[model samples]
Target: MSWLRALKATARSGLTVERRRLEPLVAARAALGLALVVGATLALFGPGAAISSAFGAFQAAIATFQRSWRPRPTLALASGASLAVSTFLGYVTGAGTHPGPFLALLAVWTFLSGLAWAAGPTIGIIASSNVAMMLVTVTLPTSVAAAAGHAAMIAVGGVVQAALVVLLPVRRWGAQRDALADALAAEADYARRLRQDPVAPFDPVPLMTARSAAAVTPRQARSRPAELHGARGLAERIRPVLASLADPAVGAPAEGPQRDRVRELLAAAASVLDAAAHAIRHGEPVDLPPGAVAALRTPDTVAILDGPPRRAAVRLAALLDDVVETAEPRTETRTPTPTETRTQTPTAAGAQTRTQTASQSQSQPKSRARPTLLRLAPVVAARMRAELRPDSPVFRHAVRVTAVTTAGYVLGSALPLGHGYWAPMASVMVMRPDFSQTYSRSVARFGGTLVGVALATAVVEVADPGVYASASLAVACAFGMYLLMRTGYAVSQVCVAAYVVFLLGMGGSAWTQTVYERVVLTLLGGVLAMLAYAVYPAWETPRLRGRLADWLVTDGRYAASVVAHYANPAGHVCADVREALLDTRAARIAWQEALDRATHEPVRHRGLSRAAADDAGHALAQFGRVAMLMEAHLPERGAPPVPAAATLAEALRRSTERGGKAVRERRVPEWDELRETVANSGPLMTDPLLRKGAGLLLDALDDLSESLAPPTDRA
Candidate 1:
């Protein structure tokens, strides 16, 4: 009986996991199948080609509807309106081959079928791509029998694909949750190690946190809706999961050795949430306390909290050990070593002293708010205009990128290779400025195509003579592709390939036996795309370096502004102060990422470019730390404590205009006096009310100027 219970438990767990994994794929399949079936069924009642063409017209209508709802919808009624008109035009152009009036009628229905809100743009793009292909089929004659056969096939295919998708939906949110948890755990471990030693030479905590946080932001944003709306209503279910974190009972640690560890983990998670919230609210970066690293590394600490958990336990344990190891100082236990053991008193003391000095050196501490007048737009816009003028290097670079890629594509399309098909695709694949992004797209394309082809082949084998089976297969393929759309390249390739293959088979192709030819064509397209990417790669370093520089420059300016305002009285002080503080925070994060990418390959990005990116990132982060200190002291924006702050601000502004390197060198006017006044203003910052307004700025000015200094080539 005990054994039987164990078996039951195992079976239940296995089934749950399997179901979770397959849900998203199932949903995609179902959507694809449904769309295909509807189109194919319409074909059975008319000439198969005419019905297919009409369905294409419907797709175009949907696409138009989608594009109409962007950046605030205008006078346009729906995307489908354009599709209907286009279909009519196509029909008119081929009136000698097919009745122009029938084509016009087909256009109206297509338009009506595509009126979905929010999804029109994406659907419209898909629709437009196929519209031309479908219009070509207008040459074929139409009748009730052909349309009926087409419609029936489409309906069947849609049903089957939709069934599959609904039955085996993919677990996108679950994956996101897992990723989020891992990122948090890694950062926590790093912090914990930092805590143990407090003084050992340590890796900067903010850098790792920034990277992890970066990854989490995009995933979290993407997963939010899916979690709210996905299959089994998992999204709805996860709402409570996110809420449960707020509940003291859910995230709080039970008392024991692991209690502290647990609290740290919870704090880390909270930090992530806070960072995400701040980014959304004020568009600023969230920086965690270095101590959070220790808590993340402890396995016993991480294992207790388990909701939508995957690998959280193992990661937690490893993180804890790592923290303990990295932060802990090395001590030499000199056991009485034979003859040499007795003479160690003075030497041991000296070694101990040296170790203490090294440890102290390592623990050095490294390193918000509200809305403002929307009226800063003119001032900001002017600044933007000056900064973004076309004569600058930035505009020149942008134009160059556009021209190169456009030229590459035109050349490819014009070439004879792969019947002029491989060239255009090649141009897109090869000429992308971002190699990684381009590669990812290419991989997705190939994989998606393969999966599509396989599915199409299966449907063809099962499809019977006449139009019903053909239409059904086509519908099924469409639904499947739609459902598996998010997972990456493979899913995309599978659906598209399958749908096209099914369409070919349904149209009664003698080429059904020549499957290899289709495969070769796709391969050829992928190869060309890869080649285009390799020939003239646009390295991501230059843009990344520029962003880093911009962030630092902006941060320094914001710091000075906040300080100046604190030194003087102003209206809308809180509003103004918060705006400056938040701006600093935001620029800091942008700087860090740019720094990381710029420094990722030192060999590839050398000399001035490398130094510029690195110095800028560090400077911004340091400047941010200063701003945080200021904000902490001055909660209010309007109070002025120190009169000298305004003078200091003027000096800093001049230095900033000269650039960070100059500012770091103390080259600005009245630099020494400003520094002295800010340093001496500490006592004034301690007053409760005055501290909230004026003291903050003084602290910020002093800290920021120092933090933005560049690193040396010290051994």
Candidate 2:
């Protein structure tokens, strides 16, 4: 009955959570996305059919590798450099050759293409750019014409996408910014909540889910550049929000009432947010600090009122007042420096005794050293092997996605007015881990394409490519824009688009006719690619949830083990727990990105979410109680001994280890002798050394538990 009730409750809660939070974003994206798709398609069909065909082919190739590529800084640079080198080498070698060996170029292209496939789009672009430059410089007439055709098609697509973004009714910027901000707030809130309630079923699953949704899309991190009008304002806003996370305290200070008061206030603030989120949908009144609501309404509240509560109104007043008013870490002043240095008397006799003590302490601590990573190595390796090998289904799927996308682009290149270009660009944007990622990519792609198109049009109108000097200047502007890669992807697309137009005009050959043709091809490729992504998306939600679960379980177990041994004395239990906690935390962080990808896969995500919640709740409960127990066991003069706790501690340790092994491996070990040994060990605290050892172990245990039980995921 209890289990049944729990299931029902979880299901009900999931529905409410999805409805109140995720649904709106989905709705908004869908509506705006449709418009973008239709507009881009129509624009492309109106221009040069051949240009559109080539543009589509390029997008298809990019789409094939879309799953592997990202706009990450290092990846971009590496890809760009590779492309530049390849282009120079290919051009120099092939320029004098008879049409160059198609197979050799294909082989080199394949290898570089594979790297682009593995590394991502930025690298692929570098390779593509090189291919363009090489063809133009190498093969006299036919090859150069083909290279120009490819470049022109790509630029057209860029312009069209950018135009769609600007003209469409979409809150693209707001969505991206909101996603990042929410993630930060969620981290703080989860930490605070878990710290206070420990056992109230703390689950990082929801937090992971939220994060996966947010991370699938990223905005440009740079501040305003010369061309971007309001980019500086956005950067300024984000910077302050990040800055607010810095801790006011520099170091650990003397424990006092002020510290206690501060803890109380922070706990209070967390509770208020939880209550608000819980109540808002139910139409119930939620209580908060006096100024929380008013604070949420202010611009300053952006940093605080994010995450689950979904309001900045309450955060500004709470944080500024709380953080500013809290007393700083107190400094401890000793007597004179000379006296402090001399306090550790090292007379010959004393030195010998001290050496013996140090050796003993070291030995004791060493017994507790259990390398957790080593224990889990087999499991991790096995999982990785399964996921990455040739036989793995996911790998096969990735290959298929790439092949299909590439085929589309190649076919599109044969078309007339470049109306096929939109299909390929869409393929690149939509081929992510989930719908959210697809949406984000689509939005960015659309915006970038449109901007590129507009820029190209403006340049052509001004320069009128019949004049070689004017056309050259236009090309230079496009190249300059490409160099400003630090700007948002959207802006960079515009620059590249304009450059495409210059290249298409064939250096003052003809301008007006080419601009329209370029736009048409790009739009054609983008549309086709988008269709592929929408039809069969692979989500990232499940894996993210799994990571959260592991962290929670590891943290909880460590806390329990630490507290159990601390309360009793003279056992290796606390040390073991601490080791386990450390291992779990490390593992949890490593798997975070994988888990985020899983969040998009609904079927797998549900299972991961459940596990994450269960583990987190257990961890919070264990850590909370352990923290309390540690505080209770604080050193004092002549405190009463905990009777018979030593025997209990040993028994618990044996039981825990046996049970843990069973849980992890599904096998029971022979434990008759271990149980007897635990039974024989009695009254541990009676020995002074044992008592001291227990006290020493407390610090490590606490640190491990806290580290494992972090409130939010940090990547």
* Top TM-score model: 1
For all predicted structures, in order, the TM-scores are 0.49, 0.42
lDDT tens digits, residues 659-699, model 1? 54544343221245445644665455433323333333334
Worst 10 residues of 1 by lDDT: 227-236
Supply every candidate's count of residue pairs whose N, Cα or C atoms clash at under 3 angstroms. 91, 89
Runs in model 1 deviating more than 4 A are 1-37, 44-433, 458-466, 510-518, 534-537, 568-573, 577-603, 608-619, 635-640, 660-715
What lDDT does the true structure give each of the candidates?
0.38, 0.37
Off by over 4 Å in 2: 1-81, 84-387, 390-401, 418-435, 463-488, 503-520, 531-537, 542-545, 552-715
Location of the lowest summed lDDT over 10 successive residues in candidate 2: 245-254
